[model samples]
Target: MRWNAEFMSPSGRVPFIKCGAFVVSELEPIVQFAANKGVTLCSRLSTEEKAEMRAYMSLITNVLVNAELYISWLDEETFNAVTKVRNSSVYPWPLGWLQTRAKRNAVAKRLKALNWHDKTLDQVLADVEQCCNSLSQRLGDRDYFFGTPTELDALVFGHVFTIITTRLPCRKLAETVKQNKSLVALAQRVDEQYFKRP
Candidate 1:
């Protein structure tokens, strides 16, 4: 089935998928970065921390997968809006306004059953730090989980890229990741591999 009128077109899905693929490809680098930085692993996490990590991972994975699937169904206007966000050179007001409105309406309806609320930047950063520390520990010296690409890698990469590359408040995570040589190398490798010009 095609995307709804509110959603963007198949072409719009290209950037979204490309972004996701880039993140998926960077999983190993992030793990390596964590190892070098002495982050704690899942096995080492306190029971509460481990639970939080699992929940955080699950939330991120769901967002990435849903975004991938949702983009596949977008119509023209929705597609254009997403492209505008990615390009950023455009005047972002109308586009951002429209996108935010659409997203709020949709999220409000879809998440009505859940106790959802906006989080402060500090809250988000704290959560991110907690998760990064946990995952980094589990990733010691591993090139990839299960020795290959996995959905977890994709989710982590996507969040890291968006949080790091954008002017969003969460860009500090990118800075933290960069502090580790391994993570920086991994991000560079992924950029060269997926985001480089043909």
Candidate 2:
């Protein structure tokens, strides 16, 4: 289940290339959830929008699966080290006996520039909400999109999970998702089934 990290870095690939393996590993439970919801892959919408959503959703799901596989391969020490580095501004490891502060600063500046987005956090959240709401409206009271749980459901579910779990600035959207009973339930189910194991 090896993945190309460079390919996974892009926003478009993040959901699918990184997340697809996770979905596959937890396919049984996910399928059960979909069955309960009566979601079908073949949606009722016309050609264009349906196709577009399906493509986006598929990419997201693939990424989630890949991420799951990556995490599973990490040992406890590695996991803790990664967690610490993510939580703290300071580097978790020694940079070498004579590393200079200026060098570190230069690296940080480069990384920040690489991650700079044109949109603000609020703007990003708004965009996510718009997509969710549009899909939800299309979904109506049905448990899932289309007739059964398709790639879209898994991708949407994984995105909600990442939103809640990560320290990204757009956490407001994640909090909002928590307020959605259906979405939260889906996230919980997916996490419990796929991510609960050591």
- By TM-score, who's the top model here? 1
TM-scores for every predicted model: 0.46, 0.45
Cα lDDT listed for each candidate: 0.46, 0.49
Candidate 2's C-alpha runs over 4 A off are: 1-84, 87-116, 166-170, 189-198
Runs of candidate 1 exceeding 4 Å displacement: 1-59, 62-99, 108-118, 176-185, 193-198
**For all candidates, what are the clash counts?**
11, 27
Candidate 1 lDDT over residue span 35-117, tens digit each: 55575344444577546545656765444333322332232343355543543333366766576556545654443333222
Q: Please report, as a residue range, the 10-residue window in candidate 1 with the lowest summed lDDT.
A: 9-18
